[model samples]
Target chain A: MSGWVKIAGLGPGNEALVTPEVTAALAEATDVVGYIPYVARVAERPGLTLHASDNRVEIDRSQHALRMAAEGKRVVVVSSGDPGVFAMAAAVFEALENGPDTWREIPVEVLPGITAMLAAAARAGAPLGHDFCAINLSDNLKPWAVIEKRLRLVAQADFAMAFYNPRSKSRPEGFVKTLEILRQECEPERLILFARAVSRPDEAIRIATLAEATPDMADMQTVVIVGSSLTRVIDRPIGPIVYTPRSTPE
Target chain B: MSGWVKIAGLGPGNEALVTPEVTAALAEATDVVGYIPYVARVAERPGLTLHASDNRVEIDRSQHALRMAAEGKRVVVVSSGDPGVFAMAAAVFEALENGPDTWREIPVEVLPGITAMLAAAARAGAPLGHDFCAINLSDNLKPWAVIEKRLRLVAQADFAMAFYNPRSKSRPEGFVKTLEILRQECEPERLILFARAVSRPDEAIRIATLAEATPDMADMQTVVIVGSSLTRVIDRPIGPIVYTPRSTPE
Candidate 1:
């Protein structure tokens, strides 16, 4: 059996989005590792052994999988979105890079999948037209200091930004401060797009503004998109959407 | 017979990357509207009507499709990437907005397709890890003044940027001037990525510097990504993919 680890993109929790190429790779693996919800997307296959855990403990789980792969297991790691976009592909690589050199020989293949940002953009029409950035608010593995630096960077660029891991109860001040910092660099009337439970039926997406979005309007599943300078509010009956471009090059 | 437009994304021109959902959407539509090459991706669909044109006349084809839809014809508008991301969706809406208001109620649906930026990033292995921006070199719709203003914003933001439509026979000077503007706010060593034909059969994605990427290295099909303060170049077998994020935060 191939001992290398394969990182598969499950694609926004919908099995329909999983490509045959990716499914064939997963079917050949002996073990799969992922967050509990993501692992469940595959249902069950006879040859696969699933290792699941809470979302907060991703690093530990990823490290465990890497160890197993190092020991000659055909491991398939799973992520809801494309593995590299804020997913386990990076975690697995980081753990390998920072640890022993013996695991360097372990081949890692990253399969692409759809991300929540694009899904929300698809639902709303064209919020991601201009230059955009995605930042996570969960300050777990990274320091708040670094996150603040990135947020400021995002605002200064005036990029349409989608914020993931925005709030979890313990991180109550997540939105208030980030929005304040963003408002300093961007306009107050700028649109802020929120998408919760995207693609899983009962999916809701809304476009509001910094002055309009309240803390009561957000939760863990929500993705907050702060519009760039050109973001506009349309009068379509299905509510409003924010539109930005890749860039406004001179 | 119902005439609806289903805008599909043909990822970087590779048939394998086009999702099944998009394929099904194409199957349901009678007429397909897009640039000549993009329509060729799904040409073999049985009982399908194909309306293809040169790149210069894409907007005209989109308008024609909307007209067909307005006449109760089920049409599908095809864009190589996501329809909303600088593709055909806006042109269709622009036509609807400029014409009769009755067309607004035509039950228009924008599906999420894989963007070239993400497709390029995936092929490059995590280049867009942190804050990034995308800009188009084409200035047909946007004025040069706006492009310069946005370029300054990109520099001050220190954003990792991907440049779309960087060069054409008409606008060879645009990329050069943009580089000069970017150098004003960033270091000379910043990695500038050029991804041409990503995920396509003849795909080519290269990482260079703003100074290094000349007009010789780019054309209409190129997608250039410029590095941020955090982006680091990793040497791999293919080439260097500039990565920004070190690890996923808690």
Candidate 2:
């Protein structure tokens, strides 16, 4: 039997957000591999084996999936959002690059999913409707200097920004510092959104201005979106709808 | 009966890529409004009315949908990709903000989907795996100077960029100028992916570099992705896989 490896995104914690393509891939998989929570999201079928690993073991997980595929096992590696965005697809490709030459022959494909930022953006009107940039705020992979530099430049460009892995138990100061930089660069009335566990039952959305935004508003599960200079807000019965206008006047 | 407006993304031209949430909204929609091609994607059902409008009529289309929803019709305003990302969601909100106070009482929601850039990135490996920016290249709504300024700053920020509406028959010069600007700022070997009609049967992805890229390589159907300095490519039997690694050296 021919074997292949498919890197798929499960989207942001909602079964309804999972694409039909991903569903079809899961049904055809002989083995599923991913972080514990992501792998848990997949059901246990009679013929399917689940390999759930801890976080920060992306390379190891990638190699395991690659090895399984090399041994003629149909494997699916899952990531919470789009696998191509800060997820397993890059790690899988990195594995393929460093692994044995035979691994190159394996049929690998990446199925896209509704990413966290987009999901969060949808839940909170359309703050990201105009030009935007997405930055990973966790300083684990990159230095704090790099993060600070990108934040400053993104603000200078006046792009609405989405921040992933903004604050964690170990990295609380980063978001605080992020707020400081935005305060320095952006206007006090600049809109910021804190969307936590988006599309999940615990989903909570908070819209605030730069002056009112605090670091404590976001955790690891939250995706923070800061609007561009042109973002507007409309008050209604349900809540305020924030969106960046499509046209920028000369 | 309280009426509501749903600005939903249909994903990038694939039935499987459309979310179940979007599918459900379409089924429930008493009136569907969107660009001609996008509206054609919906089936002709007995009770559903499809209001197909031409391009450059976003405000008009949005107002029409809002009007219908306010009059007790379930209206779904569809965009090709995620409605929040350079699509229709912002337009709908802009209309709401300018319309009468009664229109503000309507329940408006933005349903996210797999955006074209993410879909294109998934098809060609994780080229957008790291920090990235999305810019709409159409000068129809924004000034060309703003677009040029953004291109320069974004390149200096060392971000992978996804350019939507890269080219069209009427405005070919913008993409040509964009290519020239990119060539000036980016490295000669910087990777560029022109993904046309992504996720559709006629989908075509061409991998190029700053030196080899041409304006004629893209059309309105294309989404152009320019990788950051760190983006890498891996050759395989199927094709080359391009991705940007997660970590950066201190």
lDDT scores of the candidates, listed in order: 0.72, 0.94
Regions of model 2 farther than 4 Å from truth: none
Fnat computed for model 2? 0.90
lDDT of 1: 0.72
Task: Write candidate 2's Cα lDDT for A1-250 as tens digits.
Answer: 3899999999999999999999999999999999999999999999999999999999999999999998999999999989988889999998899999899899999999999999999888999999999999999988999889889988988899999999999988999999999999999999999999999998999999999999899998999999999998999977899899999999
Would you list the clashing residue pairs of candidate 2? none
lDDT of 1 at B112: 64
lDDT of 2 by residue, B4-95 (tens): 89999999999999999999999999999999999999999999999999989999999999999889999999999999999999999999
The numbered model that scores best in TM-score is 2
How many clashes does the backbone of model 1 have? 20
What is candidate 1's DockQ? Answer: 0.37
